[model samples]
Target: MALARRTLTPFGLWVFGAAASAPMVVLAGGIVATYATTRVTALPLTFLLVAGTVAVLAVGYTAMARQLGHPAAYYGILANGLGRGWGVAAGMVALVAYNAIQTSLFGLFGATMAAQLGGAWWVWAGIALAVVGVMGVRAIVLSTRVLAAVLTVSLLIVAAFVLACVGRPAAGGLSWEGFDASGLAVSGIGGAVAFCVAAFMGVDAPGSFVEEAIDRTSVGRATIGGVVVLGGVYALAAWAMGVAVGPGSVAEAAADPAAGLPFAVLERLGGWWVPLAELVLIFAVVTSMLAFHSVVARYVFAMAREGVLPAGLAQTGSAMRVSAPRGGSLTQTGTATVVVGAFALAGADPIGVMFTWLSTLGAMGLLCLLLAASVAAMTAPARVRGPQAGAWEWRLAPALGVLGGSVVLALMVGNVGSLLGAAPGPMYPFFLPAILTATAIVGGVWAGHLRQAKPEVYPGIGRGIPKTHAVPDAINVSI
Candidate 1:
């Protein structure tokens, strides 16, 4: 069954995209880790630079969405643009990447929740898994509202961090050293940029909601708007951190493991803020997981409907008058349980195993998809691209996106060990790319089999539905 279309307004789309980015978690963990790992003080500038690149990527991404009008994101785009074989390959990569991201957060959420409240980490993970599965089958409006409330508090907490840091100037007197473009030209900048880029991993999530948005334009607005809003908040908070410790010492201060930079600064406020921040950090991670659950489930639904995977996964459950993709949600929940359980059985570190390894894998895979998407936006058949497409949307923006994506992809590759924290080894660094490559190969082989045995279905891998079943473009616009 298709997701309930026109059920989400532009604000709902924004909330979904922002919740996926998880602003508070980025501030508390991503910023601290970036500074420590890269020793780069110009994170504020790096974030803005990366955001501009992503914003450029979005220009053609949304234009492609308007032309295709399909629920499946990369899968649909590649299928229409590159042909069914490439589309199915992308579908496989997307499924694995998104599911990895969705389940990996269980490690962080479980660990954080256990630290604050008493319980086994896996036990907490199981509980949240069940909760998300249940919520996933309900009317999406319910999930949107739940996420909106959680995201609101998370952003407020981020704002508080920025405010507290700005209130107290260090010896440098409100230093803007973190914003220095020259600071970014130094060594280790690639690792810093890669880390900052990971913080915005879910920004493209809005494209998946295109079929469900109240306005088709909201897809681009939400996608680009999410990047800008997230980048601004991250830049402001990172800069404020430099202000609190003096920009020159920001990287040095972050290096002191015991100090816990941002929290250390917030503690000086000397009230309930730190405790509140901790509690909300747990919620922020859960919200991020939930947001990813939505993305993964939709990918499952999109592919399943086309006979690429099991068709049963396309089934939807009607709860309170809205058709929710319960089939897809259940599949992801079950898969996550097995993956998380295996890690637990091996006595793995939640942060080291599930969180670090899986999140890094997912981040690299998503970056690959983003790059492929820009190329597809330009290469898709002109007939499928629609006659209204312009030079900027059809060509220039996507070309720029390709250049930017190539640079980011290169940085991430060069710094893969840093991102995964892999020890020196023959194959450890190549692990992520290897997994994605094998998965894509499997998908290609499956497509070849389908071409031989199920010729009809093979031809329509990425196309959403027959034209007869589609909502007209004029009607979609009016809605």
Candidate 2:
């Protein structure tokens, strides 16, 4: 079955992309943690720098969006520019990365619910899995609506907090300390930047649903819009957090961020909102997982249809020109269930083991994918000649994206132990890189075999279902 065409407007696409970023979680979790690690009054600066870098990346990304009609953006870009071999490698990395991200959230969701409500982590996880499974097998519109509602409520709470901080600063009063350049000159600057960039992890996810967007242009618009909006929200929230806690005490507060920095601030400014904010946070994580699950399901559907995986996995349920990848959704949900169950059965610390290991590993793999995609964006224009591609969009912007992604990758490598909340060790530092390298090698070998034995399938390695089998006009039009 084929995905429905023209089902998502620009707003829907933006909401979908932004939901994947999980603003509430990043604001309350990632930003606060960055202050603790770097001990630098430069949270806002780090966010701005990361935002600018991603915006540069989006220039090429959006440019390429017009040419590559495939839902698997990273894989298609690589295939069109680098080679089908690298495309296969990207596809492998994407499946692993997206699945890791989706599954990792189960730990956060379950643990948070258990702490806030009264239940076991596994029980909450199982319940979440069931809800997500139901949502995942429905039409895209249904999921987007849920994402939109969650995002709207969560962001409203965030906005309220930011306004409160601005209106009532702590002891030091309103200050721009976080944007000060000198404050960024710290020992863990690289790690801080890496963490900041990771906050925008899913900004490009909307490209995966271009085929379902109301207008092809909505894909690029949604991508750029997500980056800008998420970046602004992160930067503003971090700055407000600094204001809420006196600038002098911000670092100390961040040291135990997970202990409830945002809650503490809200309690001080608007005690009544604390309960509401907590509830919003829970829903935010749930929606984020649902959003990421949808992304993973699409990747599996796209890859399976292209013959990279079992054809049965590509099966979808279709009605009224809309299709839901029920098979792919079920496959991903099953994988999450198994992984979560294993962790619970092992009696492991859900937060320490499941969340940390998988999230950090997934972040590393995604950075590698982004790095490869940046390269593809820079080179693909030479061969495909996208609609309005120019030196700025195709060359300079992508060049910057490459540099930025490489720096973040290097930082993540050096600080992997810290990011994983583990003690420094050779084994911990090198494990993720080694796994990624092995996956790349395996994908290359498979692509080579397909090239020699199944030439027809090889050409469509990143393309979705073949045109003959796809619903009419279901594929995106080249801009």
Candidate 3:
């Protein structure tokens, strides 16, 4: 079948490309910025680890681009390398993980907006949920442009606010002494790294845009450029927040991880501008939500087309408005609705629930994907590795990156109580184990049912994976 295509303008593509990085930046940088300055001190090791992990993503991403030729190249590589089951599993992880992060942020945004505006809690929650509905099912380009404009304006306002504080440095404040991490928790390092990496989630955005690249080289160039830009943005933004607010003030700045940094800085500037700052941050969060929804929608659409998922997910908008994965759009929309509606119905605090469930879980899933993708990059053939071949990116770098990331991933699961502050009760580590197992079991059962009920339609499971194979020691990445 001929693949569906969208009629997005060049500008729209650029917007999608840029906007895709916004949520990750805020999630990674803004949220962490809050913790770094206030809750923790300037631990060189912590900052270095945070910066190094992000920098490593750039290196690995560039290597993949050199080898793969385009973002879609991973689709083929993964399908060939991991077998169908694993590939589909990878997609499951990505879709659910990304949605978790996006959904979690919705709660955070609602709570912050409500507090800043002093409005009815339900009204703000309703508005945030409403935005999700509108943005969730729309064509990618339309959503991207709107998100780009919002991110640009919101970020500018934040930058100005941060810079002003630096220029007029508060009395007896702004000194290097506060950078010390002496009293910080060694145990918290893993948690910090976990969130630090969340900001770089959009590094994979360029892969999704492979089809739109002017050429193969453009795909490679764009991928490299995107990662570099993302790392720089996070590092600089975090450092700025540290300088202006001091490391001791992160908890005070935004007691909640989901709170916007600009709103806190605005309060410092003057009490009167609090509402304005809140509104600006709301725009940023909303834009971030829409941008991520579009990105994840494409992943679902792709998985469907490949037969890893129901074909309906692969369906494009009527008249080729977008080439979103078929059958996936509805799934994506449905998931978002349930996530948004569940919290609303339960009367739970959006930010608190978001912090506890969606964002943290999403971070876990994304980390898994990154480690898997790094292995894919390293194991790819030299012909495809291009210039980055034989370099650190293809050699010790990915190996170490995966090892480091996996360790952090394990810590996140192990320390879930610390991060989310929720006891597993009798389950201990069983909560994560149960959730992951259930998701995998459901996905596996669905795949099996598809095989039995509609053998003809089943896209064969990834290349090496047998229908009933065991999970291998080596990481797999395709679905």
The best candidate in terms of lDDT: 1
* Candidate lDDT values, in order: 0.82, 0.80, 0.56
Clashing pairs in 2: none
Order by TM-score, highest first: 1, 2, 3
Alpha-carbon TM-score of each model against the true structure: 0.95, 0.94, 0.77
RMSD of each: 2.7, 2.7, 7.4
lDDT per residue as tens, model 2, 337-438: 999999999998888889877887787887788777778877784547555567886788889888987776787788887777666565755787788888
Model 1, backbone clash pairs (residues 3+ apart or across chains), number: 0
What TM-score number comes out for model 3? Answer: 0.77
Give Cα distance to truth, residue 274, candidate 2, Å. 0.9
Worst 10 residues of 1 by lDDT: 470-479
Error of 2 at 105 (Å): 0.5
**Clash tally, candidates in order:** 0, 0, 23
Q: Could you tell me the lDDT of residue 173 within candidate 1?
A: 66
RMSD versus native structure for model 3: 7.4
Q: Pick the candidate with the highest TM-score.
A: 1
